[model samples]
Target: MGDIQAYLASKYMSGAKADAILSRSEAGRPKKKKRRIDQAVPVAVGDGTGLLIADEDSLGNGWGQAEPEEEDTDVPVVTAAAKTLRLKKSNWSLPSASSSTQPEPAAEEPPAESSTATATSAPPVKKRKGGLLTAAQLKEEAEALAIEEARKEAEREQERLEARRRRRAEGIEDDEDLANDDDDDVDDHPDHQRTVYRDRSGKIVDAQAERAEQIKAEAEDRARQAAKKDWNKGLVQRNQREVEAQRERQVASTSFARSANDRDMNDELRNEVRREDPAAAFLTQRKKKGPQRPKYTGPAPPPNRFGIPPGFRWDGVDRSTGYEAKLFQKINERSRKAKEAYQWSTEEM
Candidate 1:
């Protein structure tokens, strides 16, 4: 039985196949060769115990080996039986404790692929909200721009006004030329009050008065030359003739030379007469007689045909009139006033 169990384990054969093959063993059934376990099968008597039978000739050497194996009393039979049982147990295997309950490794590959796809397929990002300008900042920028534009506009206006003022100063425009053209306004003598030298009818000049002025001027020149040692005698003689001719135009005096007593008496009498008939008294009387010059309220008038009054205008009427009339009135008024003011100031000085 032990030998049959060992054979079943070694051959990895089923129990039924092993039994059938054992039955077909010619030595066990009809061969001339001996089979010990088959022969002893009928003699086996208990569990865990088996018998072995041999022919007399085979037993002679095996009996001596059995005797030697049995010397320890627990040798050959127990060894063989334990070996066979161990082999049989190996053939009929049992499940390991670690095998049936363990779990498989998880699928990490899909998750890794999903992460890669998400990274590659996303859209481009927009900028953050903090970069944009605030409302107050935008308003301030607009105000600054407006101020700069206004400043430029003001500068342009000033330049235009300055250019116009320069043109007017240079007499480039008609309006400006009229304001400066009044020669009567300027003082004639430069140092004295401007005396209007009008005629006897307050129109034509007095020839006698003009001649007296020439004689007075010649006398003054002769006195100056007489004082100088390098006086030109020829110039003196020529000037004397001019003075004689001028004297003839005035009223003539009979006695040419005067005595010392007569000269002194005459000078005293003349002084007394001049003191009585003062020049200021004469002018004041004259002013009271004629109409005073009209006061001017603005500039001078423009020229017209025949050089009469300037342009046509009215005396005591509404000032705001047509363009040419208003222009002439302003010019005439300014010129008249300027002349009067110049004369008054020079007289005061």
Candidate 2:
């Protein structure tokens, strides 16, 4: 070891550096404490794509063979997120050239987080198509898709509801355009489109069964309508019979007074024997026509609202005496007050 140090010092380095190198080297080094081989960490290497596991076998620089690790009893195993290693200069013998192991290519992991998050979370390495999807994962994805679709449907429904509210507020009479989803061309061309039947649980059912149910319902409806018609006919016939029997009874009850002036007879029959002019009609006419009014045949005058007679004309004269005018003014005041009272009542109503 001293000769090797002297040779190194004379050839390539100072004596102190040579001694330090020899001390740190394998041959003349002191016995070191044994480190657990299992504790050796595997570093991760990046190849511009993703993190990749790096081991000593990759770069032809591996630790020496060591004993198997002791069994762990109480200490929990821990995984480090990352660890850094600084290589120390050493004189290591290269592996045999004939029995070499080739390193695999880099970029084993993905680069993007959003697209590869599911792939990284999956258990299998096969990420193509449905290979990596587990039962639970597939179910979750389906539920998520259904939820998204439901959210979109709810938004559309909300928009439709708002539109309906706007139309109603504007006093528009509209039954159409409430929902375009149902009012599509499919509704107008129902006969041209294929009809699909679905059961109560939304699963597609047999068309024959569905049609049979519809026919059964229609038949039941028709039977009900027929039964109702028969019931109405029976009720009408019963009513007619009762009316005829009542007419016969009335004829029997009123047969005792089958004369023209009988009170039970209708007005048209009684009128045949009625005396339009009574014995005191002359006195009634005298009372109703106490005064006779002369009629005017000329064109009617422009109506004056001041209680003037129809054909009378004012001669620019105040012919009313003072007492008569006072009496007329009082009457006019009373009428105006009555009119005001009527108008107030109308406003309250």
Candidate 3:
């Protein structure tokens, strides 16, 4: 009966269920396999007693192993807890409480490739000891720079002023030399001496009077010369006009005399013809018997009183007697005498 019950339980129950029942039943029993120094072991001293034990190897290993696992077995396992425990033991091991409580070490940073590049390719930045300056120091530096610029500017201005002064001195020397040369020239020529005249009040008056007289004489001379030129021009023009008129009159007189002579000859010839041919003369008389107006024999109207007729004199004097004409003649005579006197005075001066 006992063997049959064992067989039935073995066939029907799982390995884990069997183990659990056995562990409960054999609570005071020792495990078969002993743990190594780096291993974890769970021991059952009695009912409800669970104890874990770790060795020096477990303490020495700071972290659990993380290596890759081998391939799983093809056959299915009957105990999940056992398989899990094995996997835990192979892949990882828990640390002691003291070790777990300790802080972990920080990861080391990777070395930079740029550090070597920078050292080789670039110059180092120099640190200035006096990088940060005080307000007083800054002010002093600015004032020093300003003073330096001002000094340089003043030096340049001084140089320019010195150059101008030198030029002015040279110009003054040249002027003095020129004055001396002029003085020497004046001293060398006695005939070209510059006369300095001084005039008192009376001498000034005499000079002014002489100047006025000279000006007046010059004016009179100009007037006389102008009047003479005008009079000559008028005389020439008047003579030309008279000559033209005489020529025209001569021409007219010659033509009239020729006509008269021709007429007289014709009359004498006509009278001879009349005496020689009384019958012809009687015929001519009969032809000339037409009525004719009497000839105007009265003297022609008096010539234009104001304007001179052809053949009349062109003298500027009027022969008629009137107060105005006499007055005009007197004015002409006075003007002529005045012109003659002016001419004489200018000649004498």
Tell me the lDDT of candidate 2. Answer: 0.62
Among all windows of 10 consecutive residues in model 1, the one with the lowest summed lDDT is: 35-44
Question: lDDT of all predictions, in order shown?
Answer: 0.56, 0.62, 0.58
Deviation in Å, model 3, residue 123 alpha carbon:
99
> For residues 1-349, what per-residue lDDT tens digits would candidate 3 score against the true structure?
5444445556677787665655554564444433222233332232223443434343334454323324345344343342255433222334565665345567987678777766654333333346788888777676766666776798898986676578678875466556756888988897556443446643423446677999999999999997787675777787897898987886676644455557645765666644456577346452367787554344342344354343333343445547655666788899999999999999967
| Clash count, predicted structure 1 | 10
- Residue 23 accuracy (lDDT) in model 2: 56
How well is each residue in 1-349 modelled by candidate 2, as lDDT tens digits? Answer: 7767656766788767776675566475445444333444444454445545465553334553334555533345543332434554232323565866455466667558867786644333322365577888778777766666776798899997898779779988465654554667667785647677787899977788878999999999999997787675677887897898997898787656476666656654534433564654443332355776665455543433375654334334445446656776788999999999999999967
What is the TM-score (0 to 1) of candidate 1? Answer: 0.13
Write one digit per residue (lDDT tens) for candidate 1, span 1-349: 7556546655877677666665555336433433222112112123223433323542435443322222322223323332243321111223466656345566666677788878864343333346678898777666766666776788898887687679878867665435444534554546346354685577856567899999999999998876674454577886897787876764255366667778645765545534446564544332357666655444554444345452343453444447666677898999999999999999967
Return the top candidate by lDDT: 2
How well does candidate 2 match the true structure in TM-score terms?
Answer: 0.18
The per-residue C-alpha lDDT of model 1 at residue 243 equals: 85
Name the regions of candidate 2 deviating beyond 4 angstroms.
Answer: 1-131, 173-349
Q: Which candidate, 1 or 2, would have the higher TM-score against the true structure?
A: 2
Q: TM per model?
A: 0.13, 0.18, 0.13
Report the number of clashing residue pairs per model.
10, 0, 0
